[model samples]
Target chain A: MNAVLHLAAASRVHGEGATEVHALRGVTFRAHPGELVAVMGPSGSGKSTLLTLAGGLDAPTAGSVWIEGTDLATLDHAGRARMRRTSVGYVFQDFNLIPALTAAENVALPRELDGEKGKVARRLALTALEEVGIPDLADRFPDEMSGGQQQRVAIARAIVGERRLILADEPTGALDTDTGEEILRLLRARCDAGAAGVMVTHEARHAAWADRVVFLRDGVVVDETGADEPEALLVEESGR
Target chain B: MSIRQAMLAILEQGPMYGYQLRAEFEQRTGETWPLNIGQVYTTLTRLERDGMVEVVESAAEDGSDRTHVSYRATESGRSEVSEWFATPVPRTQPPRDELAIKLAIAVTLPGVDVATIIQRQRSATMTSLQDYTRLKRTGRAANPEAPEDLAWSLVLDSLVFDAEAEVRWLDHCEARLRRAAADRPAASAHATPTATPETSDGVAR
Candidate 1:
C-alpha cells in the first residue's frame, strides 16, 4: 500500500522572533491509494496548512511532503508546478471554477495547461465530467449551473487526468446537505477507484465519508481514528 | 423504544402470533432492535391489559390445556398508533446519555484533564460514525432499488447523525474548556474556590 500523499514530521511556521505563528508542528500524515482521509480541527488548528503542504501549494518550514514518491521540497518552482498539474488536484470551498469557462473547458483547462492537445484535453474532460455524473452539463457556464453542478465541474477538473492525489478543503461548505452528500459520494467513489484523497473539513458528518480521520489542534496532530473496522454501536438491541 | 406501542402498530394490520409480530418489528427497523419472544409476549399482555389489543386463544394440538394465541389491535390501539405517528416524540425526558454526564462531571472535578476525555470519546465516536457510513455505502450499492433499503438506511442514518453530533459536542466541550483555561488570570490560581463559578461562565464558547 503505497501512500500517494505523505508528510514526514511536517511543520509550517510563519514569520519568526516575537511574532511567530506555528500553523503546523511535527505532524506526520499519509493518505494511501484507494483511501480518503479527513482532516478536522478548530479554526486556528492548521487544517488548511496541512492540506496546502500535502498538495504542494506551500512549503513546510521543517520536514518534507511527498506526493506519488516525489518530494515537494526537492522540486524547484517549475518542478513543483509540473507535479501539481500532473499528479495533484485541489478542490476548494468556493468550487474555484473560472466563470468565463464552461464546465468542460474548466475541467479541460488543467489538462490543456499540462500541454495536452486541445481536442484530447476536451475529450479527457468530457470523460471526467461523465464520471462525476454531469456529462450533459459540460457546456454550462458556472453561473448557469447550480452550486452542486459547479462543484461537480470542479471535481471533474481535479480528477480530469485520473490524477493520483485529490486535496479538498471544506469542499462541501458552499452546498446544501443533500448536495454535499452527493459530492461526498462522488469523492468516495473516486477514491474507491484508486486515487488517494485528503480532505480538510470541520463537519464530522462530512468526515464520516472518509476511510480515516485525523484530528489536529494547536498546530499539532492531536489524534487519529477510523482506520480499523468500525465497531458495533453501543447498546445495540439484542435478540430478535 | 416502546415495544408495546410498536407491537400494537404492527397488529393494526391484522391478527398476528407473538413470533410474527416480532418478525415484523425487526424487518421494519432494519433488525437493529431485536426483541426476544418473551418481550413480545410481555408487551402484548400489557397492551391487552391497557385495552389496546385483544387476544384470540385456542387449544394446542391433541386436547392439551396449554393454548396458542394471536393478538389483534383493538380500536383504541389503532387510535393510539395513529396518535403516535401524528404527534412528535417529546424530548422532555431524554434517556440518560452517560457520556455527556461523564464529561459534565469530569469538567468540574479538580485535577481532571477535560481535553483528554473529549479526545478519547471523539475518536471512538468518529470510528462509529465511519462504520455507519461504510454500512451506508455498502448497503446503498448492494440494494439500491429495494423498498427495504430505505428503512435500513434510515436506521443507519440515525446512528450516523447521532455519532456525528456526539463528536461535534465533544469538540464544543473542549473548545469551551480551552477558552476557560485561557481567560482565567494567574491570580485565579490562588483563588481556586471562586474560580469554579467563573469557569462555568465560559460555557458560551
Candidate 2:
C-alpha cells in the first residue's frame, strides 16, 4: 500500500490488574505516502494513545507499529530513538519551542543531535524555516516571536530533515482563528509535499483539510471516511 | 449586516448613483455580501421617500445620454449613518439559530434524538469555523492593510466566535441531557431507547 505508517491490532494497556486501563484496543490503521489522515475522537477515546504509539514514543501491548516497513517493536531503545529522530516529526498544541535557543538553533537541534555538523544543521534549519514562510525570524528566539511564529519554527524543526511522517496533536489550539488557519495551511502544504501526516484535532473544519478521517471511540476505530465522503463520517459520528 | 445602514454610510461619503453605490459597498466589504444594483436602486428610492436622501441630479436632467442618476444623503441620512456608527449591533434576539431550533424540536418530538442533532450541528459548525479561519487568512495574505481585508477578517472572526460558542452550547446541552437522564432514571426509562444504545443501558458514563 506504500504506507508510511502501519498499525496492526495495536493496543495500549496502562497499569495492571485493578489499575489496568486500556487506552487503545485492536486499532489497525495505515497512512500512505502523500496522504494526510485526521484522527478524531472525544477525550479518553485513545486518539493521543494511537498517535504516541505510531510515533514510537510508546509501544503497544500486543500489536505492532511500523514506519516505512520497519516495525517499531523490533527496534532496540537506541534504534527506536534514532528512528524517531530521523523519520518522525511530532507537533503539539503548545508551540513547544525551546526557550533558550534561536528559531534556527531550535530547528537545528534535531539534526545536530543526530550527529550532523553544526554548519550543515543550521543550513538545513534555515531552509526549513524558509519553507514555512518565516525565514526572516530564523535568528529570533522563541520568546521574541509570536505564537504563530513560534509554531512555524516548531514545524520547521519537525520537517527539518525530510522526515516522512508528521504527527500533530491539536497544533492550533494555542493560536487565534486566522493564525490557526495559517498553521493548518502550512501543515496541509507539508502533507501535499508528500509527507504522511496524522493530526489529532477535535475540529471538523481542520479535519476537512485531511485526505481521510479515522474516528475512534472507546479505544476502537468506529468509523473511517474518505475525503470525497466527509459527510459519511459526520452521519456516523452523530450515531445515524 | 444591515445593507440599508451600509448604503447610508457609503452615501455619507459622497453622492453616488445606484451602480456606484453597489461598487463602493462591494469594495469596502470585499464582496462578502454582494449588493444587487436593483436592491441598491430600491434602497435609494426608499431613502428618498423617507427624506433620508435626495436626487443630486436625475439622469433625465443631465441630457448626456447617460442613464446614471446620482443621490446625496440628506441631513437625516447623515444622522442615520452617525447613529449606526455610534450604536452597537443589537443582539437582544440573536438571528434565527437553526441549530437551537432543531434541538428544541428534537427534544419535544417523539423518536427524535436531540443529542444526535446537537452533535451533528457542532461538527458542521466546527467545519465552518475552520473554513472561515482559512478564508480570513487568505484575505489577510491578499491585502493585509486594505480596509476590505480588515472588514472581511472581522466578519470571519464573528463567524469563528459564534461557531465556537455554538459548539460550547452543544456540549452544555449534552451534559445537561446526561445529567437529567441520570437524575430521572424512571422518566428516561419510559422514553423509548431507540437512537442511543449506549445511553439505553441506564448506566450513564
lDDT of each: 0.83, 0.79
Model 1 CA deviation exceeding 4 Å by range: A233-240, B57-68, B140-148, B187-205
For every model in order, the fraction of real contacts preserved is: 0.62, 0.06
The chain A TM-scores for the candidates, taken one by one, are 0.96, 0.94
Residue-level error in angstroms, candidate 2, position B190:
8.8
Candidate 2 residue B31 C-alpha distance from true site, Å: 5.5
Considering every candidate listed, which one attains the maximal TM-score?
A: 1
Task: Estimate TM-scores for all models.
Answer: 0.89, 0.76
**Could you tell me which residue pairs clash in candidate 1?**
none
Chain B alone, TM-score, model 1? 0.78
Q: Highest lDDT: which candidate? A: 1
What's model 2's lDDT at A53? 96
